[model samples]
Target: MNGPNDWFQQNQDRYRREQYERQQAYLRQPQRPTGPPVRQRRAGRRGPSPLVVFVFSAVGLLVGEAVNWFKDVGPVFSSVCTVVAGLIPLLLDYWKSVAEEPAPGRGRAGAPSYDRGGTAAGRVLGVLVFIVVAGAAAYGISWGVGYVTGNETVRAERLVSPVAGRADSMTITVEGVGVTDHYTKVRISAVSRAPTAVDVGVGHDCQLVDDGGQTLQPSTVANDQTLLVPANGVTVRAVITFTGRPAPTATTLTLDFSWFLAHDFGFGAHSLQVHEIKLKADPA
Candidate 1:
């Protein structure tokens, strides 16, 4: 029997009270995180923790250095270390193998959307840092190998005169001496007063004599064919190579036997002499 206006007023007050109670209950509940994992805003994919990425990269670099230190000791052990270093990047995605349940009813609808803004930027930065550190570590390790082994090569080049030696009546002249990484090459010309051109012998019998008389021969050596003495003596050119550098002062050359014997015996073991000429020291 109440008027319609009175009933409407009572109903409005009841609705307001109910809404206030519901809000109060919601506030009482504990706060919870609903956002994606840190550093990853890939809407559907989980990203690696930044801290973990940094630690993994640092460990990788250290492992790489260790590998270089022990590489010469055991190839097998070094191989293992290299493998470990190369696996660092794989750690970032270690958890990726576990399949993620897609949003219900969202599967097959389309590719999940990603927050490409800040999330993508952070991931890019992380990868860049990893690469830079890795490259620096590799370069440092290579340098360390050279330092630890003490096998650096020597390089030098200079014009030199005939040091010394002779093959009976034959004459040999040194035109240039070049010393490069791990080897030395000597250019020379040879001629014999004989009426016909004679062979220019080379091989085991040929050696380099320093001022100290250290007779060292190349583990291997070769000549451009052979030097011949034409009637006019065309001053044929020849080359000699050795595995290492000679003393600052190399003073003699020795090639043995008649030039003709060279034709009969390939790289024969014989001795001859080409005495010193305008030999001079490398400029200080």
Candidate 2:
């Protein structure tokens, strides 16, 4: 029979061989990755390109100008219009993207990639468009809110109309009568039927006489320009400003155009005047 030590040694060798084989088999098998699962990065939203920005800016400018052309409407209207236009590209892009269906067979666990405007060029173009649209929109909103509204530049209602008179061969139509913080303004259009242009002197004896016997002297005549009525049925517009505000309680006012008529050297009366210009019931 073999010795006990020899038998023990043989058993140990077999055990070691079995352990090595098991380790080799484990190494050959596919590995289950350790730590967190590697995730596919999502495509980011790109900004608008320079070309798109330029186009958008140009469009905004054109729209803004168009809106500004209406004199009755102020910059507020123009700015609002421009801003609204600027948002068009973005809105279209958003709607178009939203309207599209997701790529067929794509799932949440997959690459998660999809068409970005359909191609690489499209992506770039989309970026450009977005930039332009966004920039224009920002400018319009800022200008309207920051500059226009902050300044409170809305024009006040001032002009009163439908008052007229005639002296000699010159017909004077009062276009408007308006009051300001400092003075009252009277706008008139004078037409001369004479053969030559009539040189009307406006300063001397020109005044506004209120019902309360308050008289305000003429401060300036048509921004200090000479009042000349063109001949042969042509009309000349002039603005006459008086020094003081009329009395609030005064219901009726008179405008004396004596000096203007007298200096014309025509066939009309020198004392031409509008006896009564009815004031508004409520005064500001």
Assess each prediction's global lDDT (C-alpha) against the native.
Answer: 0.52, 0.61
Clashing pairs in 2: 48-127, 48-131, 49-127, 49-128, 53-132, 168-268
Candidate 2: stretches off by over 4 Å: 1-70, 74-76, 92-111, 114-161, 175-187, 198-229, 235-247, 254-275
Candidate 1: Cα lDDT at 174: 72
Task: Show the lowest summed lDDT stretch of 10 residues, model 2.
Answer: 148-157
TM-score of 2: 0.43
Q: Write the per-residue lDDT of candidate 2 for residues 225-264, one digit (tens) a residue.
A: 3577777899888777676667777777788765543344
Candidate 1 off by > 4 Å: 1-154, 158-169, 195-197, 221-232, 248-271, 277-284
The per-residue C-alpha lDDT of model 1 at residue 241 equals: 63
**Considering every candidate listed, which one attains the maximal lDDT?**
2
Residue 152's lDDT within candidate 2 is: 19
Q: How does model 1 fare in lDDT?
A: 0.52
Kindly provide the TM-score of model 1 when superposed on the true structure, using C-alpha atoms.
0.37
Residue-level lDDT of model 1, residues 1-284, one tens digit each, is 99999999999999999999999999999756554333334553455555665466556555654654434232233333443554464443643523343445664433443333345477667656655555555555544543344222224455554454455445677776666444556767776555554665455546665556655554442333344545334566666665556566654444332333333333433346555433346543
